[model samples]
Target: MNQINNLVRHTRLLEIVGDLIRVRALGVAFGDLAMIENIDGDQSLAKVVNLDRDIVSLQVFAGGKGLSTDAKVIFLGRALDVVYSDNILGRIFRGSGEAIDGGPELPTDPRIPVGGPTVNPVMRVMPSRMIETKVPMIDLFNCLVESQKIPIFSVAGEPFNQLLARIGFQANADVVVFGGMGLIFDDYHFFRTAFENHGVFHRTVMFVNQASDPLVERMLVPDMALAVAEKMAVEGKKRVLVLLTDMTAYADAMKELGVAQELIPAVRGYMGDLYTQLASRYEKACDFKGAGSVTILSVTTMPGDDVTHPVPDNTGYITEGQFYLHNGFIDPFGSLSRLKQHVVGKATREDHSQIMNAMIRFYSGAVEAQKKQAMAFELSPFDEKLLKFGRLFKERFMDIDVSLPVIEALDLCWLTLSECFDPKELLMKQNLIDKYFPKSAHSEAEEGETVAQVA
Candidate 1:
């Protein structure tokens, strides 16, 4: 493409493989948008995916089923972009950035190119603030720090979508951008209804690519959502939380495209660039020094519960940490937040760190005691206490439905411990114990007095 003749058109395609079409053209850069016009003059969008010295391979947004060798390919001389504005809020879009919610169109909204470079380190603020989700397991243990990029690692048959929706509505963010890839109709409907029913739709923007949609569009959903989120954070100075579901589907789309383009495969037939592709999006989560932040929380489901699967395996290396959802609970042992230290004690109450450590310690003990009991070993007095504390731990905090503020959850943690063990046996910090231990745990006199006061 040149300034003198930027509109370049080719009337012949060298090859058409699946959704990919190859054309010989000059001055076309990678990722530049194009239009493929059929003999009937019907046009579909294409993107310059691979450019090997003028043999440009474009992935047709609509599949190549009805296209012919004589179809005209016009280079658009620009990258793929999406519409952005205040009007985009409360609206839903397909992966191609077209409105699918049957709402009014905003043709006048400014468009921003998607899949851009990550924020420069010099422009980023060190993450220090916490985004409270009100879920006891998350708030009390693995705290979600602003600008953090993390994923929920689960498998099929898990309620990861439910957990994601709960966090979307409950999280402390000024704006929400949700992107769903290869979702079935029910999953898409559930998320939409969840946001509407919880009264967050007014501040939310959704980009969905259903299972029946084009595979190329699935790859576009995250980029579009992240672009809108970046706009909201940098321009509007709004704290944005981006929720992406089933990134495995996104990776699968990439794999399918790579296969169509005849690219060499890496692990499990996934393209070798899987890690790079994922990092480019995850690294978009950032906090601007003088502005707001973009925090990403995504779902990556493993096939057959295999952690070594290419998708989750590569994700573990790029993301800060992961929340492992299993058996309908965020597993205390598997879930971790690497950035939680930035806010666990500083942003939260002083006793938060102590409470979190002590609770996990006792829970680990409980697991051991349960195993010993299962083996028919004689239970020690302390084992009995561990068993009881473990039961209360799961009931009070482990359930996905358990919602409580951070402070209240900490208080409940203390109460649960007091009911199971003597105050001296807690082995927590002396200062925290003195300040937070239930008065009834120290003496029956205080308990009776408390009951009398309540009466």
Candidate 2:
């Protein structure tokens, strides 16, 4: 043991202590740098087990690949402090918030603590305003309300990243905070270029932890993102939207750390407190009683497309509703936003609620009709009409490329309905049809004649 100025550094050989390999006499300072050193070989890493009064525990980043009994341990004097400020916008940082884009170092401002206390419940306001993404399915159908906590439930190989990028570019939010966990380098570059190309980088802040980064660092992303979002929202910036991709990676990091700490596994080798951990991040989305709000949209990928996967299963309980991403598009039948009703008719046009419901009901009939046709059943006249309606509905509304405001999209719905069957077959209220339906019945008649000519 050597004492210099009041700090001591003691080196001890590695030994097993209570299911953990202990490197005795490691120098420790109060919540300072918590890092591990390799012992025998230069390439191996060790895992930190615990930290006490003057002792620091470290877990190796490389899985003890080249470590042996004799190694060196060094402790820096401080806990991890993620740098944040307005300067962070347009800058790309690693999962640990270190600038990685070959840019200048971030100027620190009072070093805000990551994963700080939640916003007070009494300070929260009920969410009301709509957050339009300009995606027809999200905007015209399931409207995303401000301060809502929603997740996109998908599987691997799906285009969730693309969907997220589109929303980041198109959302009407004042600012976007994006956190990506365990992303591949290609996907990382995809988001970077997507934001830059769309010219939204000025208002976007990204925290990325690549698959090659330290798994321990993956745990820091959500906190980093939420901390920045809270700061922006508190400053009266309305509509701060946070997008987190691959929350499943974040959970896996937790499980790995739990296993390293020798904690007994709960479900599927994950910690029993998994739900609490996720809830803490999700609950950060709230409308301040007087200030702006943070709305959260995260992607939770299920393994083998299993909805019962612990990550998605727990997420479903915590979030308000979910958007199911399937086949490179948002599935109309599977995707839903529970708060849509709050804005569908009230915040949107008078005809929105009726047209939305009627269109979906007709679309469902069309799906059933298609199945009957596949079975070679005799087609009823209504069935044929439903099939035609379904085709038009998908082309006009279900396609992701369709972009329109809520009222315009609703009017288009009425036009599509009129193009199909008569107004009475729609079963919509007569007053709505009289007010919003197309005035020229002859238009549909002309379209029928045109189709007849082609047939």
Top TM-score prediction, candidate number: 1
Off by over 4 Å in 1: 1-8, 445-455
Cα-based lDDT at residue 6, candidate 2:
40
- The best candidate in terms of lDDT: 1
Candidate 2 RMSD computed on C-alpha atoms after optimal superposition onto the true structure: 4.7
Give a tens-digit lDDT track for model 2, residues 142-186.
Answer: 889999999999999988998898888889899999999999999
For residues 224-268, could you state the per-residue lDDT of candidate 1 as single tens digits?
999999989999999999999989999999999988888999999
**Cα shift from native, residue 107, model 1 (Å):** 0.7
Global lDDT of each candidate: 0.93, 0.79
Q: Backbone clashes in each candidate structure, one number apiece?
A: 1, 15
TM-score of each: 0.95, 0.87
Q: Candidate 1 — worst ten consecutive residues by lDDT sum?
A: 1-10
Q: Alpha-carbon error at 11 in model 1, in Å?
A: 1.6
RMSD of 1: 3.7
